[model samples]
Target chain A: MPEITFRQAIHDALVEEMRRDSSVFLIGEDIGTYGGAFGVTAGILDEFGRDRVWETPISEETIVGSAVGAAIVGMKPIAEIMFMDFLTLVLDPLANQAAKVRYMFGGKATVPMVVRMPSGSGTGAAAHHSQSLETILMHIPGLKVVAPSTPYDAKGLLLSAIRDPNPVCFVEHKLLYKTKGEVPNGEYTIPLGVADIKREGTDLTIVTSEIMVHKSLSAAEDVSKEGISVEILDPRTLLPLDVDTITNSVMKTGRLLVVHEAVKTAGWAGEIMASVSESPAWDYLDAPMRRLTGKDVPIPYNRFLERAAVPQEEDIVREIQAIVSNQY
Target chain B: MGSNKINAAYDNEETTDARKKAAELGLTNEDLVSMYEVMVEIRHFEEMATTLYGLGKVHGTMHLSIGQEAVAAGAGFTLQDKDYLINHHRGHGHFIASGADVNKMMAEFLGKETGFCHGRGGSMHIADVTANNLGAQGIVAAQIAMAPGVGIAIKMRKTDQVALVIFGDGAANRGVFLESLNMSSIWDLPVVYLCENNHYGMSAEVGRVSGKVPFKDRAEALGIPGYFIDGNDVLAVYEFMKNAFSHARSGSGPVFVETETYRILGHSKSDRNLYRTKDEINQWKEKDPIIRFRDLLLEADIITVKQVDEIEKKMAKVIEDAVEFAENSPEPNIEDVMEWVYA
Candidate 1:
């Protein structure tokens, strides 16, 4: 095992998959010669040649639609939408055609394609550029939504998504690309719909994903000194959610605090709360499930307001402490 | 009589040359008869469907391929079992000619459990995977763009099969259609794009929608060979399709065919015949493919009027039985609505 940044891990997954399966190819803007916008796929063109590493025009619809077409014809394509917000332009193909094709054709057609995008705010890419839209994609029925918070998970999960017989919306947190973690070389996959328990505690179950997983874990360590133990659960995949892990954590803690960078209104946390409340964890609840999410506002350019719009480690620390203390 | 004489004069030279070519290609009379039967089957199926819809038995939108049956019939006759097909909204003829279960197709339109899609997908979306009828889409030109991908897969799997995509004249204007054509041409994918130009795209005439460049010329501009044919003539359509399919099967890239025909009905069930004049309708009706083909078979003494009537009666019975079966079949379970929403 060796330490690698999240971006490197993703690049490794692409390289390995392309080498292993000739059908697998990469297509996106600047992904070939200029590398990806995040530099994750840097130097891939030199390795795989121009045909496999396609440099597409800045048409999100064309990129996604071509991927859908390629995937249908037995090519496994990894299409990169430069930014997650730009996914809006290609939603019809991804949500309507690629996602629904397998079921619509009665399991006769499978769109084994990966649509990777750099998601969430923190890069000062205000308003239109910075958005945490994982919740919106999670709401779509036929897509498998994955948001990996670590380098190890990124490599493992991207491999799993590539091999998945369904369409996957793989969201990578923009800020976490440079974050380093131990990743084993060679083939490995982290199964979708599984949650990782980062820190175990009895006081409160903190459910989160993407970069918020890292924030929650850091906050948990800080709150542990204050006599409040927090259990941090990272739901690696959103659609086929790991409800059992969160429910079991809630059963032990008797308290749940859902935290995400997405806006609180109709966010992925709401689905988590609904799933938990319907399970056996409902009887084990000591308090109402609390959601600490970004304020429902467009991320502004002003640093203070931008920070206020999303949850930070301090916010998670304060919210979890208050929930554990039962403070009003 | 002068027009007939000229047509006969051209036929003498063309048919003699075509027969010589057909013999060189080892095409038997059985193959010709089978091809003719496919065209008749497709025409009969669409006519029955249109009649049922007019009688208010079938619901929702229906885009009949009555006049353009020869295009689908000819192309489908050339497909191998492993070959794939993607069709547009007016796709019943394509599916029927490809040997999709007639009962399941009728059941699909009736929204029944016995439908090809288990009643979930209706007429425009009917799909039979086992038969390699990938699916039909309502979106114009969308399916044509995906044909190259199917061709790519067949090539990758080392299967000597090609993908046949059929769309209407309206689809040629779409960017996806051109994009897919370019990709297929560049990659030399085993595919054929059959553009059935029935002269209407929901009340807008083809002449109004498209510049007067002609459909086949568009393909020629893309550096691919294009074939223009009278789609009403089944044998002519078949001959052109056979040439195209063989070219693709031999790894010579894709071909484009423009089938000139007309739609007898409106674009959909809600459409009124307000766009065209009564004289125009009567003119095209006189050229009705089913009637024309029946007359041709009668003139050639290939079969008696009684035999033709027997075929019609048999197809009508099949349609009626399918309708009854669909009417009796149960609706999809409400609980299952959320099941297929995910993988």
Candidate 2:
């Protein structure tokens, strides 16, 4: 395994998939010659040619719609919506169309496409550009939502998302793109609906995903110095949530805290907490499950305000400390 | 016919000329007769659908293409089985003309297990993928946005298959419509954009909703060749589609066609006819495509009055049997509610 950036991992997955299957192609705004807004698709056009790497008009609706269309017609289309916030433009296609087409058509159709949505904040790219919209996509039942927090997870999960016989919404955090980690060079897949426990501990559990996974790990590392062992669980694929790992971790740790960068109100953290509460792991929990997520406000542009809006390592650490102290 | 100014530009005379030269266009009497029969079948099917809706057999409200039979039937004649068709909500006519089985379609409308979608998709979402009818979308302009993908697939597969996307005046105003046209044009993808200008989107008239801009100009602006045709004229529509389909199959990119037809009935089941007067309804009824085509066939000696009567009688029996099959079919099992949600 070679250490590679998350951006390179995603690009490598696309390049490998395209090489393995001619049906696999890339389509989106500036995905061709200009690379992508986040440069995740840089040099892809030169490798694949204009045909495979389609540079589309700035129409997000048709961009996703075309992917659904191509997928049903036996083509693997990986469409990129430059920002997760723009996923709003694609709700009709991704949600009402792609998500529902297979079921609505009585399983006669398969939208085997991947909509690569580069998401989350931390860059100075204000409200319109920096939204963690994975929750919006997760609400749609037929869609498979995956948010990869590391280079290894990004590459493997992307491979699985592209090859999956249904529509998969692959969410990548903008801040994690350049982050480097060990990733296998050729081909591998991390199955959807599986959880990855980054660190093991017995005192408390922090279940998180996307960029927050990295933050939680850092927080757990710092909390270890204070003699509080913490467990970090990342539910990489949010839709088919790995409840067993979450509940089992809670069962061992005896305390649970859900962390995310998305707004606190109706965030995915609530869903995770509710799942744990309903499971047999309920009796094993010695403390009430709590959420350490973003503030209930639109992401601010100011540097300090932005940091304050979402959960940082410090917030996660504080939450872990409070949970261990039996604080509400 | 009375108030519509666009119809004056392209009228039934062009269709009459096409009808006269049907043989010259390599259409035999049998082919012409078959086309006529399809139109009659569509007319009967729509009338039956209307009756079904009235009796509350259809699960949801359906957009009926009652008066616009020729646009669907004529295009159906030109399209091969391999060609793709992306239909709008008002797509029963498009489906039947695309060689859909009436029994399956009726069963779908009735929410029966034997339906094409296994009753998962009712009237608004009927799709026969095996027949290349991609599916009718409930959202306006959704099919327009998706047509280019089918075109891309066709180009990639190196097939001569052309995707015929049928939408309405309402959809033309949508952004995806322009985006799809631009995409298909730039890529030189095989797609034929057929806009059935049935005058109104819902309650708003086409001129009011779309303003003074015609779809032909909009298409031309996007680098696509646009044609304004009389949609009520079956022969004319067939003639235009023959060329449009050929142009698309030849890798010449998409051709935009606006068929100026009228929706004889109200928009949907809930429409109260308050938007327009009965005079307008009766006026479009007189220009009915089925009757017009039948008379043309009769005058040309391509089909006799007795043969026309026979087609009507045959279609009536077909629809009646479809109704019987649908009514008698078993309901979908509750256990399978979540079956098709994935894969």
lDDT of 2 by residue, B38-86 (tens): 8888888889988988787777777788889999998888889999889
Best by DockQ: 2
- For model 1, which pairs clash? none
Model 2: lDDT of residue A183: 91
Q: What are the lDDT scores of the predictions, listed in order?
A: 0.80, 0.88
lDDT of 1 at A237: 92
Candidate 2 deviant stretches above 4 angstroms = B1-8, B11-13, B17-19
Clashes of each: 0, 0
Query: Lowest-scoring 10 consecutive residues by lDDT in candidate 1 chain B?
Result: B4-13
User: Lowest-lDDT window of 10 residues in candidate 2 chain A?
Assistant: A183-192
- Compute each candidate's TM-score over C-alphas: 0.87, 0.98
Per-residue CA lDDT of model 1 for B240-301, tens digit only, reads 87788889999899999887778877888778889899898788888766666556556655
Per-residue lDDT of A1-328 in model 1, one digit per residue for the tens? Answer: 7999999999999999989999988877889767889998898899888668767655566567768777876689898999999988778678777877666665567788999999989988899888989877887778999999999989999999999878899999999998999998668899988999888888999999888999999999998898888888898999799899989999999999999998889998899999998999999999889999999999898888888899999998888877877883
Restricting to chain A, the TM-score for each candidate equals 0.98, 0.98
